[model samples]
Target: MSRRRVGLTGNEAVALAWKQIRPHVVAAYPITPATQIVERFSEYVAQGEVDTEFVAAESEHSALSACVGAAAAGARVLTATASQGLALMHEVLYIASGLRLPIVMNVANRALSAPINIHGDHSDTMGSRDAGWVQIYARSVQDAYDRTLLAVWVAERARLPVMVCLDGFTLTHSLEPLEVYPDEAVQTFLGEAPTDGYTLLGGEPITVGPLALPDSYMEFRRALAAAMERVPQVLEEGVRAFRAHFGQDLPSLVDARGTEDAEVALVVLGSYADAVEQAALRARVRGQRAGFVRVVTFRPFPTTPLREALGGVREVVVLERADTLSGLGGPLGVEVRAALYDLEVRPRFTDVIFGLGGRELRDEELDNLLRAGPPGGVVYLGVEGSRVLELA
Candidate 1:
């Protein structure tokens, strides 16, 4: 398949991929970093390049509510938001998943504001981790494009909503070169949303978002969990299909490098993983066996793959993009430790919480992490105060 190569920011790449998917409905509100995704996609809607219903909702809550209605109505739905905008959509997020509506949303990860920082961070998506959604993190603009297209298939198969998360300014605003498959290839790969799932549209009238009372509440929620349990395999199949169709090789869950006999390892995500990997390579040249793992899937939390990936390392440092505010560790830190808890021999763990609200980690900063070994406990990087968090 001949592909078109173009330079695009993550937001623009998402817009391009969503255009190729050509969803039936898009109800979105503007928020920093994420706003451009819908903005450019709306342009395609206006130009009649795609026949999509573009609804400019009043707020993020209304945006997702509209998505739930559309998805329930059996329309292929899409939306985008970041930070506080996502916080506003908190309630409807689970409702979309609980009702088994496969709504695909693009989240440009950003920090929640008190002092009003409009920068990239995982706080938004991390906070919504338990909302019954499949979260896929992108490592580059190419991934932002590829994952957005693949997410439609994964979400429909999982019978749950999916969030395609990309770094706000890091990838969302920076342009990079990537190949987009021919429109026919994309169409064939996506195929069509399956109709076997429960629906509130077309077929017999079905009561959705029903009052489960006590008797069926757990069952309903359990059904959603059961659906999520099937996502990892479904996603793997989707990746295989995508590879066969587009000849693009992609790791479905976790991307691990140099883990074999690795003495030191760093776990990171999004674009930051690139920097960490480079630092690991540098350490390798200096006679240290270092590696890094990127957790691509966040929601279903691929514990099995992560555990196996970290198992071989003697020392592991979990680099968290968002603070858990627990005074102990960040979200990813807790997850890593929990994943490796039962392993017979696990890597020594250290949590470094940094890069909130778009703090950039220089190559040297990451290099020092491996060279210096574990910091013993939670270390707050890039903070000048040097007082809030103490390294044990």
Candidate 2:
């Protein structure tokens, strides 16, 4: 039950977790922000620290395709990517998830390029939301490590692929104090490399990812949906096991802070939630009753918990780092509003889009925005001129 406190970047911490699990195979291509994860783990492979088959594929698409093959053949698999790398793997993402391969991936969330920015945003992962993989966002280095381990167990139990996303440059590269658990603790919690159900090797002949025409296609999809419905239950079981083994709590889905008695709540995801929490405290000092909720698990959308967290609040502002360009608002804004739709007395909700392509929002600006309460319409924080978007 011993833990070590050390300084490591989010990428390093995640790699350490992979090292502890020592999966049967890891297939990845180097990409910005996320490159270091595979880069560092490659070192582990060279040193023979773990008996893993490290495959350095030529491209992201090839990397993921390799992972799908390995996972289908009953080998525990993992991979890493960001931005366009993830976009390139678009087709395979569905293949991996659709086949219910328990292939875990670490995504360094980055803004997709047009101007070729190599910084943090939710665009990369959010774009793949409908691909059917379970998505978990990490807010800190320790979160990146702990959740990566949790994702492995969750993926195997659910027989679905999982993505552990950390903000690209922000968390992936930033050094922070992290508490790392012993290898035995992680191994015991995750169990051996799940050889029973995942076996595609030396087993009865089976068709993997077989063609399903109209009539049968919908049924297969419905089964996938059923698996998604069971994620919350599986996630809770993993959280409880993690807490019992490591003596640390991993709050499932969303993490709520100071929302019980507050009148204003700021909802956000990833490392930026810390900024909102700080602003909330500052607003509270001015007697504004502000609080912040960080959405840790994005996929399968934590509707019930989110509704309960903001149940008492009068105003809720959803701050999304990506534009999502839905012609409506950001993805998170739409989800939040819909989740609270059934409430008897709904809070005044506003969507504030910010930090696209890695734009930074100053602390004073964030505090001022929170203190001022929900704006009249869609506000684009930190963009030049015209903060609110008035759709004609």
Candidate 3:
């Protein structure tokens, strides 16, 4: 489990990890940032290194639908896509979770299109937030690989699909040296998927995907909710197991720096956290007592942990890369605010939206944004017709 560096782009790292996991089926269609994932998996299949069925699905919807079939047939299944591709599969996404299928997917976070730009943004995943899947964000190429492996363990254990998210172009195309783990270690950690006569070939003839009446429908949805509620606990256990095998524990809710006594805090998700951390470091050196909280687990939304982390701060800035345009609120910002609503001593909260359509954000820009915002206010970063100085 000792660390050794080997350079790789985030997509390459995920592909390598998928190979190690040895899923029974892979159904994918090409999309930027995510295309490399399926391409590398296809190569593995061609080389006979992987024993899985690689289905070149016609569309994103088909890819997920295929995964649904494979998973229901009691096969370990995987798929990868982004943006519109993810959007197309939106319906099946809910089905994957509601049916309690243990399919694992890699979502290369990207902006959805009318003008059609393919770059890193949370729009794709954020749009599908209610699909009843557990989502985990990756900050680096190494994280991409490690999380993909963990996603399988979490999904199968909980019998719910899991989305392993990576910032498009940031980690997807960015190269970094990563330590590749041995296959045997991975197998030991993930263990064998449970089998109970759910297999397609099993003679017991079990039924799946049947219509549910109003009485049973609510109960099924409740079951899905209960499974999601169990994710945080299972995630903690998964991290412990991963640490035992890989020697590096992944943070579940918040990754913190200088938060113990900080008066001002920046809360963000995904690769943006790297910039926020740098800004926080500079602020700390200047005796500003600033820190950051990175949301690694998005779907069961980590409300309790976030509230505890930001509760003592005098000022809290919620930075989001995705916009909830219909509601005119940043998705992460709105969620963070909701989490703090019941606290007696809530921090001064601000919403700062930046880095949309893959807009680049520098550390200095983050520092300035933090400085410009007032306590208990929402500030739009990098917006036209706004008084805030444009840092780009």
lDDT of each candidate versus the true structure: 0.88, 0.90, 0.87
**Which parts of model 3 have CA positions greater than 4 angstroms off?**
2-4, 373-376, 390-392
Clashing pairs in 2: none
The 10-residue segment with the lowest total lDDT in model 2: 383-392
- Model 2's number of clashes is 0
Error of 1 at 361 (Å): 0.7
lDDT for each residue of candidate 3 in 1-392, tens digit (9 for 90 to 100):
54557899999999999999999899999999799999998999999999999999899999999999899999999999999999999999999999999999999999989778898889999998989999999988888899999999989888999999999999899999998888889989888877777666578787787899996999999989999999999898989989998887899766776777998998888988888888888888876889789999999899988877888888988888888885547888888889998999888778877778898876667777656544355666766765555533
**Structure candidate 1, residue pairs in collision:** none
The TM-scores of all predictions, comma-separated, are 0.97, 0.97, 0.97
Models ranked on lDDT: 2, 1, 3
Model 2 segments beyond 4 Å from truth?
A: 195-198, 388-392
Off by over 4 Å in 1: 387-392
Tens-digit lDDT string for candidate 2 (1-392): 78999999999999999999889999999999999999999999999999899999999999999999999999889999999999999999999989988999999999997989999999999999999999999989999999999999999999899999999889999999999899988889988766665356845776788789997999999999999989999999999999999988988899998999988898999989888889888888988888889998988899989999999889999998877676768899989999999999999988888888888867777776765556745778877764532221
Q: Which number leads on lDDT?
A: 2
